[model samples]
Target: MGAFLLAWDPGGALAARIGVVNVQQVLTQSVAGKEATQNLEKEKVRLQGLLRGKKEELDKFAKEAQNLQLEIEQKGAIWREEERTRKTTDLRRRQRDLAREQDEMKRLLEESQRDLTERQRQAVTQIVKELRDIVHQLGRDDKFDLILDSTASGVLFATPSSNITEKVLQLYDRKKKK
Candidate 1:
């Protein structure tokens, strides 16, 4: 890179302050990240509970339909024609209701899961944007001419003095607190 730069310009390159950030590490270890993770987990659990309840209700409905079917099988032979027809109609109605309810439940679950995923994505995007801004702010304050995200950049080597993940994380946490 230095050779390429030298080839491009006759004059020698000038000294520039450079900093690197392990963005993934900062996001995982930072206070705001932890809080966001916890909140998402809690929401996930709550949604799981709601889906579980809906499943339980469906299961109960299914069991009731099964019992009615067995009753029709056992007692249907001895009943009058009209009574048999009424019981058969009732059983079919129950089956249809169960299928409809199951479909509705599936739709609700899918919609909820999609919403949760989108929310998570939005939250991460917002955090990344904020982190980017903070990185620029810190770079300016510290007189860094360049700041690179090691997680995304192809940077393979950086000195300890150039690594500023901790400082950025600390500043991020502080700003979030405010």
Candidate 2:
């Protein structure tokens, strides 16, 4: 029992050096992250513009249809039955065309949204990959035995001295600049 107690290093003299990193901080502060955000915002703006234009077009079509209906109602009483029927048929055909156009526009908007989401996901993935590489390099260069993500690890408390998040961000930005 005495020998076992002597051999045990309770002071952790041989324990691995631990490092803590705030991954969210690094992700939000890194240059690559900023660029990714800007790109996503630009895509969102462009998509919004397209959707707005389509909506305007739909509104115009609706107004035109309304105007045509009003005209038919005003003149139908004086016209022959054949003419009135022909005009009603034209209005129904135009309504169907308008519905088709509206459906197409909705489809286009959904597709654009999907495409934008995919692109944003890819960009975030790429940033995460780069961040991993940077963290790995930092650990190797600094001789860290273990680096843990504070956020993911549910670390409620850690001394500021043990945190390496800022260093990782600096290294990442420096490498990106090159």
Candidate 3:
């Protein structure tokens, strides 16, 4: 009963209405090449370095706090309880200051990363629109029934004859050159 309900309803009819392209390959090789890849990598490295430096500062603060804790433990017994309490309060204040700085740094880093991602997404979206236009023109020229992006769909095994990625890239490159 389950198999009967799940049987193919459209069969060969749906196959006639679809075509596919590897947009990932098209964008990598055609739209943004080695230069764009390198620039993005350099930007990533710079951002990482900034974050690392901030983390190092935080680590240093943690180390100072740890040292103060040790000092308090050693001096805690020798001093009057009120004197020990005052030193502990001072140490706690320092820790709170460091924690606030670390939190602000983390928030800024997250916001910067989000901004970079949004900008990259916008640039990719614009490039994809241009590629789509090129592909649509080619589809019209070839009278294709439909066009699909194999990369977006996670299609691993498309026949070379059926794939139009290279052709679209060629047209897109030519258009760019002109």
Candidate 2 matches the true fold with a TM-score of 0.87
1 or 3, greater by lDDT = 1
Quickly count the clashes in candidate 3: 0
Q: TM-score of every model? A: 0.85, 0.87, 0.74
lDDT of 1 at 147: 94
Better of 2 and 3 by TM-score: 2
Could you give candidate 3's per-residue lDDT for residues 17-90 as a string of tens digits? 45688888877888454345666678778888888898888889888988988999998999998999998998
Which wins on TM-score, candidate 1 or candidate 2? 2
Which pairs clash inside model 2? Answer: none
Clashes of each: 0, 0, 0
Query: What lDDT score is found at residue 114 in candidate 1?
Result: 95
Tens digit of lDDT per residue, candidate 1, span 30-137? 887888788888999999999999999999999999999999999999999999999999999999999999999999899988988998888788888999999999
Evaluate model 1: give its lDDT.
0.91
lDDT of 3 at 17: 40
Return the TM-score for candidate 1, rounded to 2 decimals: 0.85
